[model samples]
Structures are given as C-alpha cells and as structure tokens.
Target: MNHPSGLSAAAVQVYRLRVTHPTDSVTELGCRAGLPPEVVVAAESELTRLGLLRTSPAGGWVAVGPETATEELVAATEHEILQLQVALGATRAKMQALSAHYMEARSLRSARGDIETVRGLDNIRAVIDDLARTATTTVDTLAPGGGQGEQALSAALPNDLRVLSRGCQLRILFQDSARRHKPTGQYVTRITAAGAQARCLSHLPTRMILYGDDCAVLPIDHERTGLGVIVVRDASVLGFLRWLYDHHWSQATDFFVDEHESPLGLSSVEAEILSQLASGRTNPTISAELGMSERTVARIVAGLMERLGAGSRFEAGVRAVQLGWVS
Candidate 1:
C-alpha cells in the first residue's frame, strides 16, 4: 500500500504503529521497532507538530486529541484519491460538453466575433443589469480587496435589496479585512438591514459573483487589482462556484451587526476592539481607526488575546475568523 506522502512501506508501518499506540513511551516504541529511543522521540515530536498526534502528560504521543483531526486527515486523503478519479472521469465529460458548445458557438462566433470590441464599464453594467433581471432565487458573492467601484455597488445592492424585498435570498461573503473599512461596514450594515443575508470569511479565494445557477463571474484581467471577467450561462462553472461558496460558508460564522449587543455581553465598542485584534490589526492601527490611544488599544488587544488563548496576532485572527467575530 502506497502512503499518500509517498513514504516507504516500512516508514508507513512505523507511523501507523506510533499513532495507534500513542501512550507508549519512546523507549518502548523504539524497542518494538529495534530503533534508537532518540529517533522515536523525534518522530513522535514531528507528528505532534503536524497535528497527527497529541503529547501525553508522561511525554508520550497519542493520536490527535480531537476526533475531527483524524476524520479530516482521512477525508483529505480520500478527497485526493477521489480528485484523481474525477479528473479521469471529466476527460469524457468535457469532450462531450465541449463538442456541443463548440458546434453551437461556431455560427455565432463567425457572425458576431468580428463585431465584438473592447468590454468596458458599460458592458459590465449591462451584465449586472441582466443578472439582476434574471435572478429568480438567489445570489451569492465574494468580494475582496475593497475595489468594487461605486457604480457596481449601487447596481448590485439595489437589485439585491429588491430581491430580498420580494422574498428572494441573497448571501454575500466578504473577507475579514473588509471590516476595517468604514465604508465596507456601512455597506454591509445597509444591505443586512434591508434583509439580505451576508457574512464575512477570514480568508477567501479571489472575488466572485454567482447569480443563481445562470452565471459565475471571475476576474479575467488583473484579479488582484482590476475588474473581473464574468462567465455567464455556464452551469458547470456555476456549480463549482456554488460548491466553493458552501465550503467557505460552512467555516464562516453567522455575522450580525449587533452580535455583541446580546443580553449578556460586551458593548459594541469593546466588541469592535476584540474584532480588530482578531482581524490581525495592530494596536496602533486599531487605535488610529477607532480614534483611541495606542496604549488603550494595546491593553484591549492584549486582554482579548489572552482570553482567546492566542499566543500571537495570527492565531487570534484564525480563532476570530473561526468564531465569526471579526469577519
């Protein structure tokens, strides 16, 4: 049996045995394997760091503490295997789909391809308008890096708000970094206030817009800096985007503007302070943004970091993102 990481058969056996008998001391494990105690100890330490094992009070190793880690590792390995199978499957699927689409597009391409010129802002607006008109059930979007201009925002928001008004669902995903922007918060607040559901993920892929099952828009130009290209009428692409959205949505927390205003909780200001730390913002930046002194911000960030069991800002960000406090 080949290990996923391509470890030798003997090494795989050693790893499996170590995982199964985590309470065994290095001396015992080494004795069983006819290896040196130091080697076993080093291997156990490496596994523990990789999150495949947990260290015991007696300094022995056990399998990961949470059942989820074991399950996740197994699932990840299975997913890789399945992905290989799916790639083989998709060769046939793609050939059939491409042949059909190619024949259909041939005539249109011959007739209209020459007439098509540069796609500008107007073209983008037209697409957005078409999306708004066609959306029947839902719209899911992920926006990152804060450069979705005013016009696009206005067009998308009104239509989305209208859809929400008429009982259609709208869910938007934003990165945790967006929370640092006042304008972004205001926009999110406005949309959420109008009944559109929205949440923020700590980290996400490039920005995208999914309109029901009809269209998926991704950046064709500069994904990091410029506007994106929209892929319309592509069900397969839409399905992929939907799957990606669901995966991130599962990891994201339900974001409410007033989440901190619960019957028993911190005030909004305190919550924002905690959220800033969670977003990987430095105390000085938080102080500048929130209009507080750096010292106060440091104290607040420090207290929240301690409470969250985070040793560093990055860990705090991960925890906060997991809990949906900041993003």
Candidate 2:
C-alpha cells in the first residue's frame, strides 16, 4: 500500500471514498474502502489532523479539497522549520560562549610563569588590545601625564566601547592636566557617556592597567613607557595593585566637574603648582615633575600671581599660604 502527501494508504483510500460519497458514516466508509471500521476510524483521525476531513454543516462528516489540505500541511511544516531555526541560533550562541571559555582556559594553562615581559611599544599595545578584547569583568587604567593625543584616544575608543558593550566595567584615571586638554576631555566625555567611569588626580605615580583580577600591566619604567611593559599575573601582586588603585580612586575627582566649580576656585593643576612653589621648587622642576612644558608652567604661575595680587614668585607663595591655598 502506497501513501501520498504524508497520508497513510488507508487514510487516502478512506478520504477518496468520503469525497465520492460526500456524506458517509465510519462503517459505510470502511465497507466502501474495504477497510475495517477501526481502521476507517483511525484514518478519519489522521485526515482530521491534516485538515482533509471536517464536520459538515448538516451532515456527519465531509472531505475538504486536496488543495486546502496541502496548504495546511505546508503551513505547519514551515512553522516547524522556523522553530528549528530559532533553536539553532540559540545553540550557536552557546557554542561560541563555550569556545571563548575554552580558549581563555587554554591560554591560562600555557602561561606558566606569573610574570611576562613584553618589550617595545607595538608589542605592548598588542597585548593590551588582546586583554581588552577578552576582558570579562573589568578593565582599569591609570594614565599619567598631561593628556593623550587625539590619534591615540581615537584608536582606543573602539575597544573601550566594545568592553562596555559586553557589560564589562571600564574605568580610566587621568592626570588633572588632562582636564585642560580638549582632546582628552572629549575622549573622557565620550567614554563616560558610554558607561565608562573616569576620574582625574593632580598627580599619578605611573601608568598601569588591570584586566579583571587575573592580570596587571605596568610600564617597565614610568619615565620611559616606550621601552616596554611587564605583565604581572601573580595573584598577590595583583591584589596589591587593586588596593592601590582603589586608594587613588577614592582621592581622585570626577572628570566631569568643571575647573571653575572647584571649592577653592583653583584647578587641580594650579593647586598642585602652588603647593610645589610653597616648597621652594623652581618652575623648571615643577614643570618637569608635572609633565608640563615650562611655558605652560610659567603661564599658570602668572595667572596665580595676578589672582593673589603678588608681583613676585616669592610673594605669590607667601600670599598663597596666607590665603590658605597652600601649607
């Protein structure tokens, strides 16, 4: 017995008899189709399932046209296919997540030592890029100096946004002088608007970056960052670095605050300059230590002198102390 359109042979025969009769009881249909009553009943159920058989307005049963049944069967199959496609998409996502976990685990296993040295600026940047791409929890950065150039900031923006897009934390700390640099300010604004945290301190010890609790990157020499970097994976060292970061973070000011809004009416850089002058530090010394050009330092000093109504640097320092601007 052959079947057609997914219908059993008995079901097809029963359907044909019902179609010809147009009105028939299960026993009569079975007698005509040469099938038993039970077989006819089962076939009727199959036709009903496929929409080939339905109750008539004034009779026991009727057979629908093959076109309507074919349409109904095709629609149900298409719906099942759509459901399967959705299931496949979800499975693919899970597989990708598992692969990432496996790769990270394998890399960890291959990294035998707690300390790895990455020499040259390009190599260091590459490692940092990889870390940003793989960061799961947090990416912390301490950038010391006046500010970063627009090119460098632009280059980092994509990865910074990517980290935040994945629900990872991205926090950056820049020197107070960076607030006056337009490009740095714009970069900070963009990132902070994208869920990244940013702060500024008057001075910072060095450049360091942390990728979650797993690893930390530090310049080989704070004064010579272009030389290379050292990646520290020692848990104890990472713990200490995190502690230091937290401490500095507590003392830092939010980057969004305006310089004019300071309680003392002095920007952080100006206040730091005043403090160094009070200690009898020369302009060049302050300039070099603060990573500012001598001309910029001189300009800031002139502004401070006028604000304090002092004509000489010595008088400016004394007046700053008297005004409680410095100790």
Model number with the top lDDT:
2
Over 4 Å off, model 1 = 1-118, 146-152, 222-228, 257-327
Each model's total of backbone clashes: 3, 0
Candidate achieving the largest TM-score: 2
TM-score of each: 0.43, 0.62
Weakest ten-residue segment in model 1 by summed lDDT: 109-118
Native-to-model Cα distance after best TM-score fit, residue 1 in candidate 2, in Å:
76
Model 2 lDDT, residue 46, Cα: 91
lDDT for each residue of candidate 2 in 27-54, tens digit (9 for 90 to 100): 7877888889999989889989878999
Compared with the true structure, what per-residue lDDT tens digits does model 1 show for residues 194-224? 8887775545666677767656667665333
TM-score of 1: 0.43
